[model samples]
Target chain A: MPDVLAEALEQVQREVDGAFDAFLPVPEDTRARLVEAMRYSVIGGGKRVRPLLVCATAQLFGVTRQAAVNAGCAVEAIHAYSLIHDDLPCMDDDEMRHGKPTLHKAYDEATAVLAGDCLHALAFDILTMSDTSNDPFVRAELVAALSRASGHEGMAGGQMMDIVSDEQEYDLQQVTRLQQLKTGALLAASVEMGAILGRVPPEGRTHLRAYARDIGLAFQIADDLLDVEGDEEKAGKALRKDEGQGKQTFVTLMGRDAARAQAEILVEQAGQHLASHGADATLLVELARFIVKRDH
Target chain B: MPDVLAEALEQVQREVDGAFDAFLPVPEDTRARLVEAMRYSVIGGGKRVRPLLVCATAQLFGVTRQAAVNAGCAVEAIHAYSLIHDDLPCMDDDEMRHGKPTLHKAYDEATAVLAGDCLHALAFDILTMSDTSNDPFVRAELVAALSRASGHEGMAGGQMMDIVSDEQEYDLQQVTRLQQLKTGALLAASVEMGAILGRVPPEGRTHLRAYARDIGLAFQIADDLLDVEGDEEKAGKALRKDEGQGKQTFVTLMGRDAARAQAEILVEQAGQHLASHGADATLLVELARFIVKRDH
Candidate 1:
C-alpha cells in the first residue's frame, strides 16, 4: 500500500481542495452567506475519491493538469451537492457528516437547499469555463456526461428510488440499480469525464468504462461493508446505520463474507480492464484496491 | 393589437412546447414517472414568455430557428425548475400552478425535488447538445450563460433572499435585487443567450441586455398588477396571492396607479432599446408591450 500511487493520491487530494477553494464564491461577496454554505458543504470534507478517479484516469492519457483538475472539480462539486441534499431532513436526515454538522444544521434548511443547488450549477459552470479546456467540444462533452450522471436519469432519480424504498421493499436487483444511479453514476462519470478531458475516443474508452463499472459496484459494496464493520473515528460518521435504518445493503443481503469476497473479485476484474493500458493505469487500478481495503 | 408579431408569438410557443417534449425522457423508460412529473411541471403550462423572449431576440440576429428553439427550451426548463422549487412547502407552499396541482401535490415532495433537479439538469443537457450549435464555443457560452443565470449568483441566490425576506424586511433596492436575481437574471439570460446564439459580441449585446432589464422589471410589475386585478380563471391559478402572503411587490410599494404607470414607461423604454435594430426588432418591441398589457 505504501507505493507511488498512494503518494500521488495524497498530492491529488491537496490539488482538488485547492481547485474547490478557487472555484467557490469568496466570503467577501455580498451574497457571502450562501457561498459560505456552499464552501462548507464542499470544502474540508469527503475522501476526494471522485477527484482522485478523475486525475488518475486523466493521467492515463497525459491530460493537462488544469483540464484534469477542472473536470475533477466538476465531478467533486456534484458529489458534494448530492451529499448536502442527501442529508436534508426530507432525505437521509443525518445530522452529522464527515465529523461535522451537516450544512443545514450549520446554516438553515433553505440555505442548504440553495447551496446544494448552487454547487450543482457551479459544476456545470466550471466545466463550461475556458480554463477547463480550449476545445469547446470537450467542454460540451463534460457537461453532457456530468449532467446525465448527476441528473434525474441518474443520481436524482436514484435518490427518489432510495427515499421511496424506505417506505417499501427493494430486492437485490432494485437496490443495485438504485446504488448504480445513486453513487456509481457519479463515480463512473469521474472516470468518463477524465477520459473526455484527455480526448479519449469513445472506441478507446470501452475498457476504461468497463474498469469504471467494476469499480463502481465494488466501491458501493465496500461502502456497505464499512458501515457494518468500520471504526467511526476512521469513517468520520456513524457506522451500522444501514442496519438501524432497516435499509437493505449488499452486506445485509449477501452476507458479510460473501459481499467482501464479491468486492475483492470486482476489484480484480476492474484491474483486468486496464490490462491494455499497461503501467499508465497503475493509479486507477490501485484506487480500486484502495476502495476495498481503506478503513474509511 | 392583432399584428404579425402576435402570430409569430403563437408559432414560437408551439415550437418551444415541441422542444420540451422532445427533450424530456421518454414515457416508456423505467424512470418514466420522474420524467412524467418533469413534463407535467413544464409542458402545456404557462405563457412560455421566456422562450418567446429567447426566440424573438434570436430572430433579431437572424439566428437559425433550430438554434433559437434549442436555447429557448433551455431557458424554459430553468423557469420550470425554479417554479417547481419555489412552490415547495418550505418555500411558497402553493397547491396549484397553471390550473393543475403543483408537482409535489400531484406526486410528492421528494418527486417534486427530484423533478426540479432533473429539469435543471435537462436545461444544461439541451444547451450542450450538438443540435444547439455545431460550434462548441457557442454551446459552451450558452452553458455558461444559462448556469450563471440559474445558479447561486442568480436564481438560487434570489430564492434564498426571497425565503429569508419572509423572516425579515427588505427595502425597495433589496427587493429589486432579489427580484432581479430570482426573475430578472433568468429573463436577462434569455435575451443574452439569444444574442450568444446569434454570435452577437458582448459590446453589441449591451442594448439587448438593457431591453431585457427593462422588460424584466415591467414583467414583474405586470405580474404584480395581475395579482391585484386579474381574474384567477384567466391567470390559471390563484390571484391576489402576493397580498395574501403579505409579500411586498411593485404594486404594494408603488401603489396600483404608479405601478401601472411605471410598467408602461418601462415597456416603452424596453422598446426604445431595440429601436436601433429597426424593423427587425418589431417582435421584441411587441413582446415588451405584451408583457405589460396582458391580463395574465
Candidate 2:
C-alpha cells in the first residue's frame, strides 16, 4: 500500500474509535450493560474501510477532517449495527467477527439485539448532530443518504435476498443485484455522505457517485474472492460458508480468476473516475486498489 | 371519550395507516418478503398514540396536518420497529402483538430482525424527506430527537433495563427510571417532534414537554394496571407476564390502587400543563385522560 493511503486508513481507524468512545459514555445505571455491549462491538476491531472512504471523498472538496470523521463514524455505526444483527443466532448464527465472539456470543442474544438497535439509532443521531456539520442542510442530507442506504430499499433489502439465497437459485444478474443492495449500498453511501458534508451539489456528484459504485462492486467481488480462498486467521471470521452452503457468489458464478480480474478492472475504473481530482485523489485511488488487494 | 377527541384519534389512525401504506411498497423481486414483513407490522394495529401526540402538539402551532402526520409517521415507525424487536424470541419472545402474530412468529426470526431494522432506518428516512418538513433545520432536529429517543439513552436503554428486571429487585424509583427511558422517552419525543415541525423552539416547548412527560408516566402506569387487572382478549396479547416472571412493576411497587390513582393524577396534571393553550389543547388533554382510562 502507498504510505499516504496506509497512514490515512490508520488515522481514520483511530479517530473513529475515539469518536465512538467519547460519544458512548457508560452510564452509572443498569443501562450500563447495554451501552457496554454497544461499546464492546463498536469501539474496536474491523478495518474501518467505510470511514476511510468517507474521509477520502470528503477531502476532495476541502471538508474538515473532524467533520469527515464524524460522518464516517455515523456510516461505520450503521455498518457495525448491521454486522451485529447479521451475526445473531436467528440470522447467520456466526460466533466470531473480527476474530472475537460476535455480540450475541459476547453478551446474550437479547443484548446483542438491543445493542444493534441502539447503534442503528446512534448512526442517525451522529449524522444529525452539529458536530457532523455546521450547516443543517449538510447534516440533513447526510442523514437522508445514510438512512436510505441502510433501509429496506438498500442494505436490509439486500440482506433479505441473502437470507433467501439458501432456498432459491439466483443467476449472475440476480446475485449481482443482491450484492449491490446488501453490501454495495452502504459503501456507496459512505462516499455520498462525504460529498454531502463537503456541500457538493447533486449535479457535481456524478463522478463521485460513479467512483463509489465501481469500488462498491469491486469491494464485494473481492470479498467473494476472499471468502473462497483467503486465510481464516487473517480474515478474522468464518470464510467459505458460501461454498459450504452452496450459495452462488461472484466467485461461484464467474470463476475465481474471472472474479479477481473483474475486481481489478473495477478498481482501475474507480481510480479513473477520480482522474479529475489529480494529485489530491491519490489516497482515494490507492484505497480502491487496496480494496481488491487486501488479504482481509 | 368526547366526540371531538374520538374523532381526532380516528382521523389520525387512518392517516397514519395511509401514510405507512404509501411509504412501503412491496417490491416485485426476491426482496418482496422483507417488504411484506415490514408492511404487515407497520400498516395496521396499535392505537397510533405517538402519531396523535405529534398531530395534537403540531396543531397547537398551526402546523399543517399533512406535515405533522408525516413526522408522526416517522415516530410511529420507530415505535413499530421497537415492538417487533421487543417481541422477538431472543428479546421478549412473545408470539403476539396488536391482536396479530408477532413478526417473528408470522414470518421467521431473521426476517423479523431485518424488518425491524429496516423500519428503524425508515424512520430517519421519512424525517429527512421534504415531505416530513421542508426546512432543513426541522428535518435535522427531527432526526436528532427521534434517534436520541430511540437509542441507548432512551427506549433501547430502557428495554435493556426491562430485560434485567427479571433478575434484579428494582424499587419504585428504579422502575420509574426504567419506564421513563423505555416508554417516556419516545412518547415525549412524539410531542417534541410535533413541536419541531411547527417551528417551536426548545424554550417554547417547556409546557408541551411537561405535558408529554406527565402522560408518558401515566401511560405506563395504566399499562401496568392493565397487566394486573385487564382481560387478555382486550389487551390483545398476554397479560400478567410481569407477575408470571415476578418482575417489579408500577403496580407491584405502588400497589394496584395507588398505581391507578397516580395515573389519574398524572393525567390531570398533564391536562393542566396544557391550560395555557385554552380550548386549543382539548385534543391533547383528552388524549392524556385516555392514556389512563383506556382498557388497552
Model number with the top TM-score? 2
The runs of at least 3 residues in candidate 1 whose Cα sits more than 4 Å from the true structure, single-residue gaps closed, are A1-6, A27-30, A167-169, A244-246, B1-6, B27-30, B239-241, B244-247
Worst 10 residues of 2 chain A by lDDT: A123-132
**In model 2 chain B, which range of ten residues has the least summed lDDT?**
B89-98
Positional deviation of residue A124's Cα in model 2 after best superposition, in angstroms: 0.6
> DockQ for each candidate?
0.65, 0.95
lDDT of each: 0.86, 0.92
In terms of docking quality, model 1 is medium
Evaluated at residue B253, the lDDT of candidate 1 is: 85
TM-score, cand. 1:
0.94
Superposed model 2: Cα runs more than 4 Å off = none
- Which residue pairs clash in candidate 1? none
lDDT of 2 by residue, A89-184 (tens): 889989889989999998999999999999999999998878789999888999999999999999999999999999999999999999899999
lDDT of 2 at A38: 92
Per-residue alpha-carbon lDDT of model 1 for A154-231, expressed as tens digits?
888788777767676778898899889888899999999999998999998999889888899999999999998999
